[model samples]
Target: MTHNPSPRSRFGIRFSILARRWRRALDAHLAAAGLTDATWVPLVHLRESGHAITQKELALLVGVDGSSLVRVLDILSRQGLIERRPDASDGRARLIHLTELGEQRVTEILKALREGEERLLVDLADSDIATMLECFDKIEERLAPATDSKDTSR
Candidate 1:
């Protein structure tokens, strides 16, 4: 008798493969903007913030410790993509903001990322893409419930 893999196992394997390929392509595109995957997370957070933000807040947004986040921020600063300034209200706190050049580079990186995602799904029909999105939404809703304890009721 032949054995068949469980659906969960197949899904996990495919997800891993797809994630690696997607990240690899995205990383290459980001390199042209003088950035890397390591720098992308914080950069995205800063871009979304749209104005000067505090380092402590940025750390929370990036989900990293102060020491680690400092290293990434240093790299970005060295590249002239970001700047750090003292907070007027706080004596010791620092504020961060993306430079105009950083904003432009991020725009290019975003465009490249969109194109890469489209390329990855090029073989799928529009209907398939819609179905895949719907299934993913349902799966996420089931398995990745809201983090708030009140939402989970457990």
Candidate 2:
């Protein structure tokens, strides 16, 4: 007889379940405002920058590859939510800018996201939430140095 392993032992499976759940909830919220999670992420980052950002920088910030970023940018541009303009210093490069519609859509989506996040953590105490956020920040900080080191070595 063959023995079966516990599903909880699989970290990827657990993470995938959590990710899908979060994305489903977020996608529903964004859909009400005529947007999807994929559309909102990049736009939110661009809005935060508040200035024209190069395509390379945007791709890095969004944690996606150049080819994938180009597809996302194309979709957003087609929807009139973003524009790609020639870079002032490097004519060969392009800068991505959010349109007014994009800005407004992001504002609305952010509000919804905040609400969704609040709902997700509704059962957790305020102190617990604060501690969770701090832990996440620490994890990011620790990982960032390793990532930088690898990039530099490459």
Stretches of model 1 off by over 4 angstroms after superposition: 32-34, 48-65, 85-95, 134-154
Model 2, backbone clash pairs (residues 3+ apart or across chains), number: 0
lDDT of each structure?
0.81, 0.83
TM-score of 2: 0.74
Candidate 2's residue-wise lDDT over 1-154, tens digit each? 9987776587558767987899898788778867776678899899988898987777777778878888899999998999999988888878899999988878888898888878888899999988968977987898888877755422
Q: Weakest 10 consecutive residues, lDDT, candidate 2? A: 145-154
Query: Quick one: best TM-score, which candidate?
Result: 2
Off by over 4 Å in 2: 1-20, 149-154
TM-score of 1: 0.65
